[model samples]
Target chain A: MSIDWQPFLLTLQLALATTLILFVIGIPLAAFLAFTRFRFKAIPEAIIGLPLVLPPSVLGFYLLLLLSPASVFGHWLDTWFNVRLLFTFWGLVAGSVIYSLPFMVQPVQAGLQSLPLSLRHASYTLGKSRWQTFIHVLLPNIKPSLITGIVLSFAHTIGEFGLVLMIGGNLPGKTQTASIAIYDEVESLNYATAHVYAAILLLFSFAILLLVYSIRKKLQGSITGL
Target chain B: MIRINITKQLRLAHENTQLSIGTTIPSNTITAIYGPSGAGKTTLLKILAGLVQPEQGAVEVNGRIWLDTARRVCLPPQQRSIGFVFQEYALFPHMTVQQNLQFAAGKNGDKSYIDKLLHLVKMEAFIHAKPSQLSGGQQQRIALIRALVRKPQLLLLDEPLSALDDAMRHELRTELYHIQQQLQITTLLVSHDISEVYTLASNLIHLEHGKVVFQGEPQQLFGAASLSSTLQLTGEVLQVIPDGAIYTVEVLTGKNIIRVTAGEHDIAKLQTGDKVCLFVKAYTIALKKMNG
Candidate 1:
């Protein structure tokens, strides 16, 4: 049996897009949650962190109901621009973001938490605004952790199956990612094709993980002058 | 030309905690806040630096209102032109020593000023080293100069030398005193070490449980009844038990045993038969008659 490479390319593209979007949204959100003391903070943190423990199907079900026509949010989205987020690439992206929420946040939180509070205080007392401190002092320090989160989220999104199945329904050329394609091949009794994708995915994930750990090691070494 | 005036009342019924800031740190003087832990030395420094908000208080630097809590006008710490060094030597661990100074300086491509700062701190050799890579003393130096790199209206150091060795700390204290004089930046330092106050402080603010017990010069503080009583004693070295964190220097005088915290240098020179004078405060003298 020959290998079909379309799904592989689509999966890589989907993973890259999800990683980029999560980076854009996750870093600042994590930074804020890790640093600030605000009223109702626990609520947003609980909501953001809800997906970490909830089964992918449960989160997917809620998202589905949320986007359904009967829901007020769905009506607002439609009224706003007739936007439908049930079975599109955007829907998949949305589901992946939620599914990989902890992957993005845990490392960032750990990064920020491990930072000495004195750094921020030093910057604050130097008459540098909170924004300036974050950009200049905080970001450089947490770069390794940020990279770890991005890489983990990207790889984990690539491997996500439950959320994609619930929200995307294996729609090829639209929402069907590599994991779905592999599942489809397995269900169709094409063991050889399944093995090809599975082997490729395994090798790719290992490669990514190796690359991440190596980079992280170098950062730690340089940081501590080892 | 730095002035601070604030009054904070903390009546816990079980424990009373009231803080009043009615003092002006003289220009170009390193005013030391000397007190035990939890005596609000850091709090006083924070209040002066505009990092803390008092219920009803105010702070004036150079005759400008930095915080007027009663009038409901308080500037955030970021807007206050003050240099601050935290106790933990909060240098950016991810940034190189050079980058840390440059970040504090807020320069785009200018490296000359950073070089000068590194030289000022005697850390020019470790410009490329990260904070984690540097020693505690080195980090403290970087932290000090990092605050000074901005050239603010006032400099505040919170137990900066507590985490350093004796030689480094003593050397840096001299360096800081000299720098504070040369730069003419009014400085405030918080420490529990009486020796540090003696060495670096021209004026002393002794805090006891969040209230100012004595606000005067170190010479006056040593002469005060409260400080002198607890700190003055007469004894000799009985035993030196090293517990790693600090050596318990037991001084024996007649039937009385006086134990005090001393550094390795003092501990090394002590012997069982050596007669010595222990000048401890009365409050610190625990009367138990060990030989009864």
Candidate 2:
């Protein structure tokens, strides 16, 4: 029995897309959480961090409701953009991004917050604009954290099960990811195919995680000159 | 002239206090702000550099109003062409020394000027190395040049050499004074070391408990009057003998006649029977004119 390649390929696509979107959105959000001094800043911060502790199924259920055509936002998107989010490939991506939000945000925010304030102050006093400082100074300094965030977000989205199932369901070649494919194969008593998918995912996830840990260790050593 | 009149409320560990500083720093002069820790010296520098906002204040630099709290005019740091050297040498760790200078140089700055600055500090060979690879003294040299890359109208130095060794500090102090004189950029330096302040600053502002306690020449604050209050002895110049370039002055401190070697500049105006105060600093004795 040969393993189906569609789900594995789709998993890669979904993870890549989600990670890319998160990279764009996470940097600004993490910067806001890291730098701003508003009184009620903790409210939005807690909201972004809620995914870390909340059950994936619970998050998936809300996302499902939010993406359904019955909802106002869902209806507006469908009416204006001719798109339906529920059970679509983009729906899987949307769910995965939310499910893996903390994986991307926490690391970047930690990196930004860890930097010395004088770094930015030095740039500012040199007549650099805020964006210039962020691009030239802040981003270069937080590279290790950026890598950690990207790797974790990509790996987390690839292995996600509950949130993807709730929103995207198990549609062949579109939304059915490798994790879901493995689950379906096992339930159908296709042990050979299930084992193949599981083994590949396990090895891939292990290697990716090992690479992240090694990179982080190397960065720490270089940073401390240890 | 850079005129600054600022008041800020500060919350200390136990009490709420106010930092009220009002002074005018003359253009093309190095004004040193001398104070102990927690005396708001750094805060004053930050306020002048536009890093910290004053509760109620107005800062006018060369007729340009940088900040006026009552008028709701506050230009951000990016708009102020001010060079600031932080105590920790806040160099961009990821960039090499050359890149660090290039980043601060912006578009209007040229490569030749960068090379010139690197040459001036004798750091040309290490320009390609990152800040972390360099020693503390090297990092400060890079930081100093990075600040000057913009040719800012005002330079604020917050104990820029506090991290170096004594030898490096003295060497850099002389370089700093020469650079300041050559550029004639109005500068404000914050230092706790009396010798460091006296060496570089022509004018001194003494801050204590967040208030300007004294503002005058460095000599007035650290000269004979202040030295006599510390470890100083009153003496009369009994005899002055010139030995080659050095002058050996014999001072009669009551019963004892203390022999002190003085520089030609210090002994030029001294003659027999002139009252003087001898103060020893760093194991070297120096004479100052005594007040009646």
Candidate 3:
């Protein structure tokens, strides 16, 4: 039986979109969580970290309810913005982003926190603004964490099954990612096709993890040399 | 002139301490904040640099209001136009020496000034080197020049030479003095080394438990003049050789190993590693060349 490339392509697209969006939003969120001091910081921290512990199906179930047309937010979006998020490619992307948020955030936050406070203070004393310091000094120094965040977010999104199942619901060419395609093949007794999908994912994940580890080793060496 | 009167509540490892200080640092002079560990010397420097906010205070540098609690005006470190060399140097590890200095220099920063500063420290050859590649002394020199790149009105050094070995420290101390003299910038130095304060600072603020116990000339504070015709020196005791009634005590003071005679009463409490104050009568002390 010939393998359909559509699911793999859709998975790549979703992973890329989710990883890009997460990268854009995650750095600032991580910086805030790492640097800011407030009375209720743990509340937001806990909320962001919920996906790490919450079952993917449970999280997906709540997300499905939140994005359904019957919900106020979904109804508001449908009426005002004319945008639908449920069972769409964008919906899958959103679900993946939420599902893999802590994967991106925790590493970046830990990296930022591990840095010396004087590095930021020194930049400030030299008349560098907060944004400049963050972009030029702080971010550059935490290269390993940034890599980990990006790679983990991408890989996690690609490997996602339960959340996509709950939200995207195997809509071929729209949201049926490789993981879902593999599940469909298994249920339909297409063991050969399922083997193809699972093998490719396993290899892809290993390569990504190997890249992260090697890059981390090199960065750590350079940092210690410094 | 920099006039500062600030109070901060510091939470240290074991207990909380209040840092209450009021002092005027004359412009174009090096003023040393002499204190024991955990006396809030570093905190005071940070306060002046706008890195640490005091509970209540006013910092007027050259008549520019840096911080005034009454008016709720606290300028951030960016607007303060001050140079601060942290104890760890705080050089950006990712950047080259040239980039670090250029970053501090800003858009209008003079390229020649960067070259000149490097030349002054004899680190021009290593301009393209990163901070990690440099030795402790080299990193410190870069840190010093980086601080001066913007031509700041106030220069704050928090134990800038504390990390160096004795020889490096001495070399850098002289280099620091020359640089400070050449620029004539108003500087606040936090140092526990008495010899450093004596050699470099014109004014001294002696802090204890985060309070200014004394503020005056280093000589005035350290010079024990109550006993007229007496010379005072602080040193660590190295050995106590008992030669009958009188004990020959060897003290390591500054770079010198001086031997003084003490009686049984003085030798009773003294040990190998005890810090002691040596008081010599003016008439009894003599100056002689090493060769002679």
Candidate 4:
């Protein structure tokens, strides 16, 4: 029994890709939640925040049902792009986005909520649109929170288990990630390889967590933080 | 012409409040809303800035109806060309002084104009400095110029000088006056600081419980007609009247009869409502401006 390096590299890529995608989508969503006020706002907030307390497998199971050909979203994507999501690498990204959305949102909501309301009002009086103000003013002010969200998302994706297992379906080299690889090693009684992969995941997640938290602390202190 | 006739129902302390403040705010002159705390002064300013909506009424500035509840024509703050200087300065802490001003200017202003604006507020030396690095006075200067760089049609200052010390306030008030004159922008200032209001406001709007109790020149409110429960009046003995402690005396150029506290001076002055000067502490006065 030997340690497989491919699974570790694959896990890194999956987490990186997931983190990047979460950033592209989550940052703007967070900006939206931070500013605009309309009727029934709490409903959308509760929906975005639902994943926080939800069971990972339940979330994965729902995604599985929703991504099937029977679902409207699934049929739309399949009709337009000829893509089947379940049991694939793309499926893992989809699951990761839902599973880790709160990790992306909570920090950002805190950042925006903590900011002085005066800045927003001042922006309004200066003749800037909500989008423009968020891009120009709110985003920069909440840099620490954004970075916190990004790094946390990356680390979280690396360490995640149930959702990825349910969605990625553990197709070796194609969809199987290091997390699954480590589990595979343990189940097959290859304790040596299991320990190796487990150690790397542990170290990687630990380092990312430390870096994110330390950077967030530095930002709080410096005030020169971007 | 800026015609503001707003009647709002606000729930300040959980009860619905009704307020009526009607004024043709003078163009290119500073109109300060002067009152005590919780007087709905800030609320009035917010309605004008489009940050707060009134239950009823409208704000017409430069012939554009910013808010009209009846017509349902409510223009957002971003659509109106007004500059608001928050009491805290509220400068974008992340951006440098220059970027703060640039953000205010939008797309039409260039770097040269920005440079000139920084120079106008005497913040050119710290143009690249972040707001966190500046002192209170310096930050205020940057905030003032940032609001001005946009060339807004109107300017709003909410306790704009309350953050600074005596010396800094003296200097900045001059700077504010100088800038407003240079830009010729109509302004509405809100401050509870009595001295600040008396020093700066060309016109005053006094509100109590969300209603306009007084609106007009500052000099008009300084006299003795509108005395409330809080302020007591003292005057030299105008008479030795038996009916109540009624003293008739001179107040700033007008003569009025007021209930007076009997003292030795009252017993010594010319009897039968004599001509003596009356003095009223500012805190005791509730005023309404007479039609000019």
Lowest lDDT sum, 10 consecutive residues, model 4 chain B, at: B246-255
Q: Which scores better on lDDT, 2 or 3?
A: 3
Worst 10 residues of 2 chain B by lDDT: B222-231
- DockQ for each numbered candidate: 0.72, 0.49, 0.72, 0.51
lDDT of model 3 at position A1: 70
Candidate 1 lDDT, B1-292, residue by residue in tens:
7677777765554776777767777777888998877677887888777767777877888889988866789888888888899888888776788777777777553567667767777788988887877788888888888888877888899999988888888888888887877787888899998778988888888888776788888988665554445555456677888988788888886567777788888778788878786653355566676462
Best by DockQ: 3
What TM-score is obtained for chain B in each of the predicted models?
A: 0.75, 0.78, 0.85, 0.75
Supply candidate 4's per-residue lDDT for B6.
89
Most TM-score-accurate candidate: 3
Question: What clash pairs does model 4 have?
Answer: B226-B286, B231-B284, B237-B266
lDDT (Cα, tens digit) per residue for candidate 2, span B165-271: 98889889999998898889999999998889998999999999899999999998667455444467778999999989998999998679999999989998999
The candidate 2 chain A region of ten consecutive residues with least summed lDDT is A217-226
Task: Show the lowest summed lDDT stretch of 10 residues, model 1 chain B.
Answer: B225-234
Q: After superposition, how far is residue A57 of candidate 2 from its true place, in Å?
A: 0.9
lDDT value, residue B99 of candidate 3:
90
- lDDT values of the candidates? 0.82, 0.90, 0.93, 0.81
Poorest lDDT segment (10 consecutive residues) of candidate 1 chain A = A1-10
Candidate 4 residue lDDT tens string, A1-226: 5567787787788888888888888877776777668678788789888877888888888888888888999899899999989888888888888777878987887898888889889998898888787777787788889898988788888878888887778889877888888888789998888888888888878888788788788887666533
How close is every model to the real structure, measured as TM-score?
0.84, 0.86, 0.91, 0.82
Give the interface RMSD values of the models in order: 1.6, 1.5, 0.9, 1.6
For candidate 1, the C-alpha RMSD (Å) to the true structure equals: 8.0
Measured with C-alpha atoms, the lDDT of residue B132 in candidate 2 is: 85
Overall local distance difference test of candidate 2: 0.90
